[model samples]
Target chain A: MTYLLKQLGREWRFMLRQRYVLILLLCSFLVSGFAVFTGLAEVAQQQQTIERLKLADAKDRLEAQAKYNDPGSLAYYSFHLTYSEPSNLAFAALGERDVYPWKHRVRMLALEGQIYESDSQNAELAQAGKIDFVFVISALAPLFIILLFHDLIASERSSGRHDLLVSTAKSKYALWGSRGIVRFVAVVLCLMVPFYLGAMISSTGFLTTLLVSIWCIAYLAFWTVLSLWLGKKLASAPRIASILIACWVLLAFVLPILSDLLINHSVHSAKGGDILLTQRETVNDAWDLPVSTTMDAFAATHPQYADYSYQGEGFDWGWYYAFQQVGDQASTDMSNDYRAAAAKKYTLAGYATLLSPPLLLQRKINRLANTDALAAFEYEQDIRDFHKALRMAYYPWLFGQKKFDKTQLTSLPQFEDSTHNYKKVQNEQ
Target chain B: MNNKKTQFAIEANSLHVDIKNAPILRNLSFQVAEGEIYALLGGNGAGKSTTLKTLLGFNQPSSGKVFIAGQEVYSALDFIRRKTAYLPESATLYPHLSAYENVQYFLSLADIKKSEDELNQAFQRVSLQESAWHRQLQTYSKGMRQKTAIALALLREAPIFLLDEPTSGLDPVAIDEFNQLVRELASSGASILMVTHDVYGACQVADRIGLLRNGELVGEYDAPENGRIDTEQVHAAFAQRKAL
Candidate 1:
């Protein structure tokens, strides 16, 4: 143990003397620090947006409640705020939160259009992505690792010190092993110190933080071992570095992109825009159709409301709501297909991670942060569930089964995020 | 030359080494007894460095065996390395580090600790200028870097030494100082095997000189009872072998 410590200490001191090495380590620290800062800011911005929208939603609903005497008018005017609150660890990953709509304000209208409204906006921006901690680790940390380790052995040989150092050292571990460990530890520390600070500030759970650290270390070990292995086979530092950089490019960028294209081609599903268009067109066409047609379609799903009659000649509230319900029902099949395709694509990407370690790390941390595509899909489902609660609360009054009472407004359904349940289940696992 | 002991500190017997299917050393045999300096003198491609590397276990012998301190090199590499200190043709110690730091780092790599005064003494013994001791090797000349490497090797205090062109870049004065140091190390019971093309330098310091040509040891010469080996005789042999 004493010998190992001495060897490590010696290499640590030696590494500090090299300006290029110190610069690389500093760059790693700064880049990772910047990533953590941006991630925290982004998550804070998202939470702030959610809080702001909640206030406005409550105020708007109270005003609508004051203006409308009837349940149908109130349900039509009152918008409930549904949002997936960013997880504590989301400050690190910020995964699909940028791509998926995490917050939605929906009224008792056709649900599909409201859900898919923001899908196409700023997609290019999201694709470019924010500099989150996970991006720093999975994508950028490997390059830092490569720069640090690719020349571990070759540099010694180039300097004509390989033979002397090897022959003089008491053991191989005392020489190369110590040097490699020192470098690996330095790079890992540089990359993870910022993340740990972020975790503390975000109050990320201990187990999640540990898991993120283990995954990052394991991923870095993959690069470290690979660089050393290639260094052994190839004597030239530049050649070894070229091979490692090529590998980084292939795994971090090319494979993920190609697999995405292949998965999209193979997995057929309705697009979000298609779902929105289908629901909107159905709602538009309902104006020309007979009221009976809309009510008949709605009654097929809600048989309990079938006995209610729409006696009003022009613009009955019950008929208007029934047609809106029918519009959602018309697009239900397309919505399910879109979600199923998205789920399949996510699953296929999970398998592709075996080919690309960076993708695997990104996926793992994103899942932990509750910002993955799975999390986004769950949020959409939560909105749908909340919409169903809204419809249930108002449908009885619309169908004349219950008296319209302003005092009962306090008992109306409110949007509650199901992300807590998901997190609970995740923690248990 | 008279203080040589019978116990061999380094031994290579019938050693064969092939690199990329080309023979680097062929059936080579030699021994350096305790308190003796043996120099392998040859021109380029004569496999002198290869022979030195073989003794250090950097290259595995295709056949036969090498032993340092009476232990087979391949089976006891850690022991061999601990017992040996090597000086390469070009002592490219970390250029970013001062001479003191490079010596300290390499000695630490050997798991040997030295007091600051001891380090200063080793630098002083190598005759590296006091002014250059704390300067980074990058700013130093070739001879200064070589002196730093010599200081590191001396600090190892190992039983065996392997020197590859140990005086390749030194000035005439520095070369004489290095030769004197080698002689002093040998007198202090260390065994050394140096590979160099400098016939006169080898004759000046070596107790015994081996002439190598085309991976084979062609001739061996020993100093007379009270005199150094004749430099003219060895130089003639080297020149004639080049003609062949």
Candidate 2:
């Protein structure tokens, strides 16, 4: 053990002397910090946009109330905003967040159309991927592993020290094992220290954050083992290096994209765009339908209002919104099937974790950050439920059966309580 | 003849080694007795280094076996290695550590823990300058690195020493010093097996010399009965063998 520690100390001193290690480590840190700054900026900008839209919503509702002042009109015109707050650890592995929308505004119209609206973003940046802890573990850690291991025995042999060292009483296992442990610790430290700092700043939960750190360390260990095994097998340095780098490219880059493409092709999701087009057609076509026909359809769905009289109305608020609710109810099953198909992609990706740890960690981070595909799907569910509540609140007043006073307007369901329970949802997933 | 056969300290009964399907050493046989300095003289590709590696158990013989001190070397690698010391033609120490640290590290690997003063004395015996002992090996010259490796081999105190062209790259003064060291070690009953191309140096220090050509030992010469052997005659014999 003492000999191993001494050798490890020597390796660390050697790494410190190599200018490239210092340069790469500092560059990685800077890149991580820059990525975090961009992530925080992106989240803050979305939050601000939501706030502006909410204010506009309040102003537009006030203007409409000055003229219509009907609860049914307010329900039809007013839009509700929903958003997911970024998790602290999201900065470390910014996976899939860029591709999925985080903030959404939805009306009491057909829920399917409002749910699939993607946020505005540059496609090139999302493709370039995030420069986060996932990048550190999956991309840069392999390079460091190669640096430490490519010449383990070949250098000694070329310089003619292999015979001398191998002739010693020390067993082969002890010699190679010590060398590998030193390199593994050094490379793992280079990844974990910056991650720990990011976790501390972001106040990530203690246990989950440690799991992330261990996952990275284990990944580096796997590479270290591979390097030593190959180094022992091959007689030349460059060949070993090339083989290890090839493995890195296959595991990190090629396999992941291949998995995604296969999953997407296998499970054909319904055209979310087609759902939006159909919902828009259905909602707008209600205007042309006879009022008696629309009311009968709405009354069948909401039968409590079958006895209510629309005595003598010129397009009464109650009768106007009855048809809107009926249009959303028309396509509920197809909307759900669309969401389930999209969510199956995540389930398929979960099976891929056993094949590649980078994918495992990628999904783990998205699951933790609550910015994954499933979260977006659940947010759609929330939109559907809230749209149902909006109709139930206004059916009586829309038929001219009751007066919607100022108190009734203030009692509308705002999106305050919907933002809670992220941590619990992550645990369940 | 003195009516005597040298008692073998190290012997290869019949050694063969194949690396990547190419025969490096083929059906070779040699021996070094206790207190005898044996020089293995060969051309660049004549399997001198390969023979040394086989004896040291770095390369497993394809057929036949090697014996060290009357014990077979096949499955007793740990036993054979513990009793042997080796110095390659060109050695590189850790570039980030001082010469003292390099010596200490090798000593520890050999399971020898010397005090600071004892270690310094070992370094001094090798004629390593005190001023450069503390400097990192990256700043060392070729001769300094060789001296450091020599210091390590001496400190290990193994009875059998295998050197592959040990004095290949040294200057005249360093080579002479190394030759003197080899003679002293042999006189103290340590068996020295050195593979070399410098026939004259081998003649100066080696008790017996053998010439290897085309993966076969072709000539063996003992020292002259008179004062000193004619190194030029031995060279002529080697050149004649190469021509054949």
Candidate 3:
């Protein structure tokens, strides 16, 4: 053990003297640090946005309750805030949150339109992606490793020191092995130290942090061993570097993009805009249709309300709400198809990750942080569940022809995000 | 061969080496006894460096055998490396390190600790200027770099030495000084096997000289008792062989 430490210590000091090596390590640290900083800032901004929206949503709902005594008017005017809060580890991954709506304010209206509203605005921005910790580790760390290790043996051979160093050293471990280990350890520390600091600051769980570290180390080991192997096989430093860089570009950028394109081409789905348009058109055209047409459509879904009749000639709350629900029912097939396609695309992307380790690591870390597409889908489902509860609570007062009381507003349902509930279950496990 | 293996510090018995299906050294053999300086003199394409590399265990012989200190080189590579010190043709030590640092780094690689004073003494012995001892080798001339590498080899204090074009960049005075050091090292029970194309340099210090031509030992010459080998005879033979 003493001898091993001595060998590693010698290499450590030797590596410290090279200016290019020092510069590369410093650049790695800076890049990793910047990524962690941006991720933390993004998560913080998201949490703050959720908090601000929650307060405003409460204030708006209170004003609506004071203005409307009828259940239908109160439900139409009040908007409930539902949000998927960032997990403690989300500051590192920040996965699908950038592409999906993490928070939404919805009234008792057609919900598919509200859920898909922001989807069109961020398609271009999502393609570019944020500089999060997962991105730094998966895509950029390999380049740093390739730069550090691609010349481990070739440089010695080029400089004419290979034979002399080989013959003089007591063991191979004392020379090449120790040097490679020192370099690998240096690059790993440069990349991971900032992540660990961010993890501590975010209060991430120990087991999650450990899993991330293990995965990162394993990923880096793949690149390190590859660089060293090619360095040994190849004779020129420039040639080895070129080959490694080409590999990085292929695995990190090309494969993921090609697979994404293939998956999109293979899977067909209804767009969010189409669903929004279809639902809105149905709701808008319902006013010109006969009263029997709207009431019969609503009664098919809600059989208990079949006996209830609207006595008022115009602006009856029950009739208005029935058509609103029928609009959602009209777009239900398209909405389901849209969700099914997204879920299928996500699963195929999981298979595609086998072709790109960077994508695989990103997926794993994002799943750990509960910032993946699955989590987003769950949040969407949560909004739907809450919207259903709201309809159940208000339909009785609306169709029963009973006198409305303002005090009964307390019985209205609140939105609870499934992401938070999932987190709670995970913590319990 | 068996008798020589027991008495010699370095031995090659009918060694053959092939690289990429092409023969480099064929049935080449030589031995360097303890406290003796043997030079393998050859020009370009004569397998001089290949022989040095084979002895250092950098290249494996396709057939025949190479032994260092009576043990097979391939089987006892670590032990052989520990017992040997090699100086490459150009002495290309780390350009980013000072002469002292380069020597210190190489020594530490061998896991042999040496004092600063001892390192300074090695540099002084090699006639490297004391002023340039602490400067990075990138700022040094070729001769200065060669001197630094030589100082490192001397500090190793190993039993066997393999020198490939050891004095390639040295001036007349430095060459003479290095030749004197070689003699001093050999006299102190170190075996030296050097490969070079310099006829005069080989004649000056080598106790015995082997003439290598196209990977084969073409001729052998020995110094008379207490005297140097004849330079003119070896040069004429080398020129005659080159013409053919």
Candidate 4:
């Protein structure tokens, strides 16, 4: 152990003397620092956007409250916002959250229409990839690793140090292994120092920070091991570097696209927008049907409302809500297929990630941050549950013809997540 | 050490080698005594470098065995390498590092933690300039890099030294200086096995010379005890043998 430390010191000094490598290391740190800062800025921006949405929703609800003393009109006009607030560690890994909707505004109307409404963002940007901390460490760090260690063994052979060093050491591992380790640690630290600062500033949990640090180191090791393996196969440093860079391009860019194609080809999921459109077409057809027909359809699924026998209906709130419920009920099959396909695609993509360490690690980081597509789905599901509770809570007053107490609005169902802790943002106006 | 124990610092017993399905070395055997300077000479195709590599445990033989310090070369390579110093045909010092740093790093790699004074003494023993020790090896001439390799050997304090074309591209003065350093090492009881094309250089310093032809030891010649070598006759004999 002592001898290895001595060798590590010598190796570090040797690396420090190499000005080009040192400059590359500095560049690596700069790039990662930028990425961390940008990621945090993105998370902050999303949080601010959520805050603004909550304030806007609160103001709109107040206007609805002034117009209606009963439950039906209030339920229809009051669009409650459901948001997936960024996790504490999200700054390090802003994954699918950029492309996916982190917040949704929905009312007591057919939720199929409002639930699918996502923020307008260019998805091509997400596919092109982001410059987050995980992106820097997992994708960019390897390039620097290749620069630092591409010629590790080959250069030793060129310099005529190979034979002498080999004969001097107890074994080949003792000499070259120490050198490999030193270079690997140097590359990892170049990324980690900036990342650690970002985590500290963000106040990332100790366990989360530790896991991310391990991921960064493991990613660097993957590249180093590959560089060394290719070093053994090729004779010249340039040849080894060329093959490694080719592999980087393959794994980082090409393989991920292929994995996406494979998952899409295998697991064909209909879009949620399609389901929403179909539900709307079904609900619009309810305009031609009699109010009795709509109530009968609603009473079939919602047997609890079956016994309310007052059907003197000329567009009553109870009759309109019955058809809205009927619309959500009629599209259940398509909605389920859409949800199942999404889950299957995510699972298959995960399986495909085994072929690329970078993707696999990014997936791990995304999970830790709760910023992935599955996290998006979880948030949407949470919103769906809250919407269901809102409809159920509003039904009692509408069906029984009982007047709604304004104080009871405080007890209504709210969108919730583990990270979500929000108070009602009442308008000052 | 007794006579038999001290007689053979290196020994090969009917060694045979093949690389990638082609025979590289035929049945061969030779030995060099402690405190003796032995040179193996051959043409380009001859296995001179291969023999040195074999002795250093770089090239594994298909059959037979080599012994260094009475330990089988392959079985105890780490031990053998730890005790042997190697100088290859090219100057392979890390160009990014200064001469002193290279020496110190290699010393540490060898698990030899020496003080700066001892490292400088080794450099001085090889007659390397004190000023050049701190300069990057990239600025040094070919001969200077060879001197660093020798200084490394001196620092290692090994019992055996393997030289592969040590004076291949040096001036007469540099070659003489290098030859004198080897003589000093031999006199200090280090066994030396050198592969070279310099017949005159070998006869000038070597106690004995072996000629290899097509992987076999074709002939062995000795320098006079009076330290006189007839380069013309040695050349004539080598040329005549080649003609045959």
Candidate 5:
């Protein structure tokens, strides 16, 4: 086709002349551009925050190194910070990142209370939740599809060209098909140009960018096909537009909210608040118990510390740490239950993603960005593992009653990103 | 008359058209022979459009058949469509497309791809004015749009032409140019079937005029070659039949 190209050229020229079409395309481009810009901005802010916190952590530990000579005093005062870094492609889609806490400061205490302490995220999101590229595709794109295609048949008929064009066209199917595809390509270009640019500038993986572009094409095709089918079926432009918009509001906005409410109402998830309250109660109650009561429980778990000699237990660092460990152990079942509920919610949401394409794409973008609920869960796991290392590092000195020199502060455990492990986890699923 | 219709370019044999169980055209029979320009004249709801649509194979006739260029229309609909150039009453053109673009696009869509020069020539023949040929059709008057349709038909070069109320909105000068163009196309051996309300214009250009009433042809007139058509008599006959 030379003929088809010529036809497409004609379509492009036509669109160029249409002020409204040009405006729609430009507006969409700008919105998506800003989404990319701010998404990157958001990720950059997180990175900077993490860097600032690490510096602060270094200073805080150095100060505590001088203040607390005993290993137990240092463990009590040290606040180890853990954070999740944004993926390279996260700028294209900041799904769930706006709502989730990516960084937290945990002390050597009962961890069930420390794990769920999210920074105030919702108020910030409410103030700054501009619909990102994710919103553009899932919510706004259908409107554009309707605008571009609703009048395909009705306008031709009303203008009195339908009979003429239909009667003389080589293949009427080709005519309609070309028209739809021309607009579809235009819509895709309008949305994806900024996305590709973001992906490029982010230095995202080449194959990933290609796969995402293809995915964008298939998703846009679904809307395009729907618009064409309804456009041809309805006899008037306004009617077609109204119906498609109604479908958009229902499918994109209302249905998702409804299903979310339903899922929340039905699913019984362990409450982080409940776990925190219980863990705090258990930890406080340990202060009244005999040293043997706390040590025996702690020793049951850490038998290596069972032989530690406790003398003058009125104010012992070893005895204090033993109780802290025992309090964490006391809430072990509740913490496990809390994690299981979160995992179940994620699973339920994964299944719910099937019914709404917008939800499906949001989850997909979240997965690519490593910014989903699962990613947060993995970060928490990293925190848990790092907390264990921190405890293990100190248990020997606290049990043997050895001097904890200030130089040992540098040897304290730091959190590592478990993205590879998470990948294995994702792949196995 | 029956013996003379063997080489007909369009043939509607005992056609009865119904839409949703309501009859639109009843036992309609007519033929436009090769190189003939036939005008089907009727008031509103007289089934003139129905007859044209049935011939186009858009509507399936309850009984009887339509044959275009010796092929039964429904069986080889696309084949028949390739042979015909249709201009509906409104002369609709894409508002965002320039006159040249509209014509060129339709030509290409009809699979009659032509050079830019040929497309320009078609536009020029319609006398669409060189200045406005590249201007978007939203800036066009009704007559300009009609002329562009004519250019499209010229490019199509189809053997059969269907013009539904082709002159409903044209000024006198544009109508004269249109009549001249239709005559040229017919003289070059294209069969023309025009459904028109302007009985006088039909009388001026059509070789034969048939009047339809209540979905049936009530009056038919044939013009002798080089003879003047009596417009007054044709109008009187149309008005008299509608009164009954």
Candidate 6:
């Protein structure tokens, strides 16, 4: 261990002497800091947007109360806002959150039309990908490994030091092993320091963040071992650099896109558009159908509402709500199938972790941050549950002929529980 | 204590090396005693450099075994390397570092920790100018770089030294100084193995000379004991042996 430490010191001193290494290291640190700051700004922007939407929704509700006190009008027109706050680790990965919606405005409509909504974002920036901790770990960390290990053997030979060093009694394995370990540890420290800082600022939990740090170190070790394995065979510094860079490009970029494309084509999403179309048709057709027919359809699935069944002459809240429930039931099968297909895609992507270390590591970081596609899927599902609660809360006032006053409005179902439930679901998983 | 341990500084018994499926050295065998200076003479592509590399454990022999300091080469590579220092034709020191820093870098790899003054002393022994010792090696000439390489070798304190064409690009004064340093190192009990194409230079400094042709040692001459060997006759013998 002492010998290994000495070797590590030599490696670091060598790096320090090189101007290019200092420049590159400085650039990497600045790049990481910029990425973190930008991500924080982005997260803050999202929170501000959510706040503004909440205020707008409140004002719209106040205006609706004065003009349309009817329970059916309030349920039809009022849209409550909800959002998922960024987890502490979000600055690390910033995964699918860039493309997915964290905040949405939902009313008491059939959820098929609202659940697939996305955030307002520039598509070009999303495609270019975020420069977060995930990018630093999976992409740039290997470049650092290549820079450290590519010349391990050839530089000694070129300087005429190779033979003299090898002529000692130390085994070939120890000579190479010590050199590999030194490079691996330096690269890990370079990545982990910034990552730890981000976690500290974000207030990430200790145990989970430590696991993230280990995952970062282990991923770097795998690359260092790989670089050494190639170094032994190549025998030339420049060739070793070329081969490892090629490996990095393959693992980090090509494999993920190819796997996602293949999986998406195989399963077929049956896009949420199919559900929206079906629900809209069922809801709009209610005006042409007799009131008793709509009530009968709603009563079929929700037998609890059968006691209040009534055929009112004109614009009764009972008739209005019966049609809404009828619309939701119409698209039930398509919605369930669409959700299953998305879940299957996520499962398939998870399988890719076994083959690609970079993807495995990226997934681990995002999972720790609670910003991945899995969390997105769960959050959307919770939104659906919140919509169901909204419908149930207004059913008695809308259908049972009870009047809703300002006090009653204050006591109505809110979206705070859905936000809390999203975090709890992530923790449990 | 001159231990009779049969301490061969380097031993290559019938070693062969092949590069790109073409044989460079075929069935070469040689040994240098613990404290003697041996010079290798050859034309271009005559396998002199390859012979040194094979002994150093850089090139694994296709067929035979190599032993340095009684330990099998390539088996205990770092062990063997730690006890030997090498100077190539053009040693590329880290250009960003001063001569002292370059020496210190190698010494650190050699596992020798020295204070700044001790490192400066190594440079002084190599006859590097005091001002140049603190300046970056990139500003130094070939002779200055070679001096720094020698300083690094001296700091390592290894038992064996392998030098490839060490006097190739040096001025006459630098060459004379390097030869004197070589004699001092040899007297200090470091075995020196050198490869050079300069026949006259080899005769001036080498205790023994070996001629290589087509990857084989064709002739051997003792400079101090069996002096004034015919170079033309030796070249003829090498050419005739090449036909076989």
Interface RMSD of each: 0.9, 2.7, 0.7, 1.7, 1.8, 4.0
Report the alpha-carbon TM-score of model 3 versus the true structure: 0.97
Residue A265 alpha-carbon offset, candidate 4, angstroms: 1.8
Q: For model 3, what is the error of residue B50's alpha carbon versus the real structure, in angstroms, after optimal superposition? A: 0.6
Q: Total clashing residue pairs per candidate?
A: 0, 2, 0, 2, 0, 14
Lowest summed lDDT across 10 adjacent residues in model 5 chain A is found at A420-429
Residues A1-429 of candidate 2: C-alpha lDDT, one tens digit per residue: 776676566556555666665676666556555655665555556557756766776677677666666566666666666556566667676666677665666766666667654522345567766666676667777777776777788777776667777786466644556656665676566567767776777678898787776676777778877888898899799899999889888877788889988998898855766666666677788888777787888888878788766646476666656666666666666666776877787888889777876677667766666667776666556656666666566655666556768568665655532432442221100
Could you tell me every candidate's TM-score relative to the true structure? 0.96, 0.87, 0.97, 0.92, 0.92, 0.89
Model 6: CA > 4 A from native: A1-3, A55-68, A117-129, A152-183, A307-312, A401-406, A417-429, B1-8, B19-21, B115-121, B224-244
TM-score of chain A of each: 0.97, 0.85, 0.96, 0.92, 0.92, 0.88
TM-score of chain B of 3: 0.97
Kindly state the fnat score of candidate 6. Answer: 0.38
lDDT scores in order? 0.89, 0.72, 0.90, 0.81, 0.80, 0.75
Reference-based TM-score, model 6: 0.89
Better of 1 and 6 by TM-score: 1
Per-residue lDDT of candidate 6, residues A175-274 (tens digit): 5666666555655666677777777776778997889878987888888778888887776888888989889888987888888888988987556667
- Candidate 1 residue spans exceeding 4 A from truth: A421-429, B1-7
Query: Given the true complex, what DockQ would model 3 score?
Result: 0.89
Best by DockQ: 3
In model 2, chain B matches the true chain B with a TM-score of: 0.92
- Residue-level lDDT of model 1, residues A1-429, one tens digit each, is 977887888889888878899999999999999999999998899889987877787788888888989887888888888889899899999998888988888999999999998977868888788888999898998899899998889998997889988887888878889999999999999999999999999888899999999999999999999999999899999999999999999999999999999998999988788889999999999999988899899999999999989877778888888888999999999998898889889999989999999999999999988899998988899889889988898888899899989999888876777774333211100
Q: Which regions of candidate 5 are displaced past 4 Å? A: A119-130, A401-411, A420-429, B1-6, B113-131, B228-233
Q: Candidate 2, residues B47-147: lDDT per residue as tens digits?
A: 88888888877788888778876667766777778888888888677777798888776766666777888878878877888999999998989888888
True contacts kept of 5: 0.85
* DockQ metric for all predictions: 0.82, 0.49, 0.89, 0.67, 0.68, 0.39
DockQ of 4: 0.67
Ranked candidates (lDDT, high to low): 3, 1, 4, 5, 6, 2
Query: What are the clashing pairs of model 1?
Result: none
Worst window of 10 by summed lDDT in candidate 5 chain B: B1-10
